[model samples]
Target chain A: MQYIYAALLIYKSGKEITEDSVKAVLAAAGADVDDARVKALISALDGVDIEEAIAKAAFAAPAAAAPAAA
Target chain B: MQYIYAALLIYKSGKEITEDSVKAVLAAAGADVDDARVKALISALDGVDIEEAIAKAAFAAPAAAAPAAA
Candidate 1:
């Protein structure tokens, strides 16, 4: 089976930001430097469908089949 | 400023999958395990807006101010 690695790009106000902004923040925060990797990541972000990605990432609780007795 | 770390959860067919699936794949792949972190990540994914997140992540080429003469 294929494998995928994902992460969250959270903003300061608890809002989600674009991958670019996330990268910028990571750079500003002094994460390791890998120019090639950064470029690849940016390109991937550009190509990704964020909405779909989120949907895939989200978890929904299973509905109860029957109510509990009082 | 607060920092957010994000990753892409890729599927076998080159399609995006949910975080749980991604986590499962990763687990299957023998990546390091962190149950607490996984739980937090799943919860965060539940709260995110994928569409908005993608829009934020997308990059649009700046319209050219002027075309160069041939």
Candidate 2:
């Protein structure tokens, strides 16, 4: 979880999301940095659009299931 | 990023984190789900404490530094 947060921190800062960047953030935050998790996070985020993902999370909650009237 | 959000969606719903569950959430939201990315996300989050991650994110910003001790 912290691994992901590290990646988010890097992404939010408009910096390139990389293993080093994540590790730096984790180190700065005084959190235990797991190499395996960091590597996995960087791998998982490959090809993922961080901006799009943030946008999706922004409207994650779906509205009522009521039918719309024409 | 959406993959992370899908996992978060599952976590938020108190459901077990699984590729199928994450895919389901993405499908419900009408978003494209890359199977490889979903698989990687599930792998990355393995053994991770989602609750702790959420808590960390909540208090992500560090308090301002000040001299308090006399």
Candidate 3:
């Protein structure tokens, strides 16, 4: 969970989601950094459009879901 | 967010991702249930391969990213 948040935070901050950056974020958050997990996240995110995925997730976010006036 | 988590939980439990089911999960988790949000989640998840998305996310999960033994 924290790992995903770290990735999202990096993407939201307009920073590149490199292994070092992810580690830095996790370390800053006091999360025990795991090299393998960081690698997997980077690899999985490769060729993935963070902006688009995040946009889709954010679109589904309940906060953004305003009901239409009847 | 709780809303997404709720949807995922329902999917994991082998239940349908309907508005009512999502609301039930959220309510069970003591989250502030919002009808609009539930509707949005259901609509967004409609036709979406929840299993695939979750698998991708899980694959990237650091806990699951156990590195090959060196």
Candidate 4:
């Protein structure tokens, strides 16, 4: 949803993903900001590797799967 | 967000997180399923450590942050 997208946007911008930053992004997007959800997201993302998660998302197809040995 | 929740439910159930499973979960929840989004989520989570990711999410607080030296 917009909450996760907001976090991803902050991640992509190389800015620290804090509650305030996420709220700012959501606000700029004209999305109704939910404070509790934003807080939960920031907490849930604690110690998560945003770069790795995003990289995985970028590989959005079975073609990106590892090749089988011939 | 329901899509992500569906995937998480599959994950938590110790079942394989396939397109079918994800769709089933969403369907059971009476949520309108989006095929493309489910496909993308499966692809995105292909190499992700879901256990590790969930563990990180379990850490949901600033108090979970590393302690500052007194």
Question: Cα deviation of A32 in candidate 2 (Å)?
Answer: 25
- lDDT of model 4 at residue A58? 63
In the range A1-70, model 1's lDDT, one tens digit per residue, is 0111222333223443445444443443334435566566656656666545544523222212112221
Count residue pairs with overlapping backbones in model 3.
Answer: 0
Better of 1 and 3 by TM-score: 3
What is candidate 4's fraction of native contacts?
0.00
**Winning candidate number (lDDT):** 4
Docking class of 4: incorrect
lDDT tens digits, residue span A1-70, model 3: 6778999899999999999999999999998766756765686689999777766555455433333221
RMSD of each: 17.4, 14.2, 16.8, 16.2
| lDDT per model vs. reference | 0.39, 0.72, 0.72, 0.82
Which CAPRI category fits model 3? incorrect
Docking class of 1: incorrect
Per-model DockQ: 0.07, 0.06, 0.03, 0.01
Which ten contiguous residues of candidate 2 chain B have the minimum total lDDT?
A: B61-70
Cα error, candidate 3, residue B24 (Å)? 41
Sort candidate 2 into its docking category: incorrect
Q: List the residue pairs that clash in candidate 3.
A: none
Give per-model TM-scores: 0.31, 0.45, 0.43, 0.44
Candidate 2 residue A24 Cα shift, in angstroms, is: 28
Instruction: For residue A34, give model 2's deviation from the true position in Å.
Output: 20
For candidate 2, the per-residue lDDT at A41 reads 73
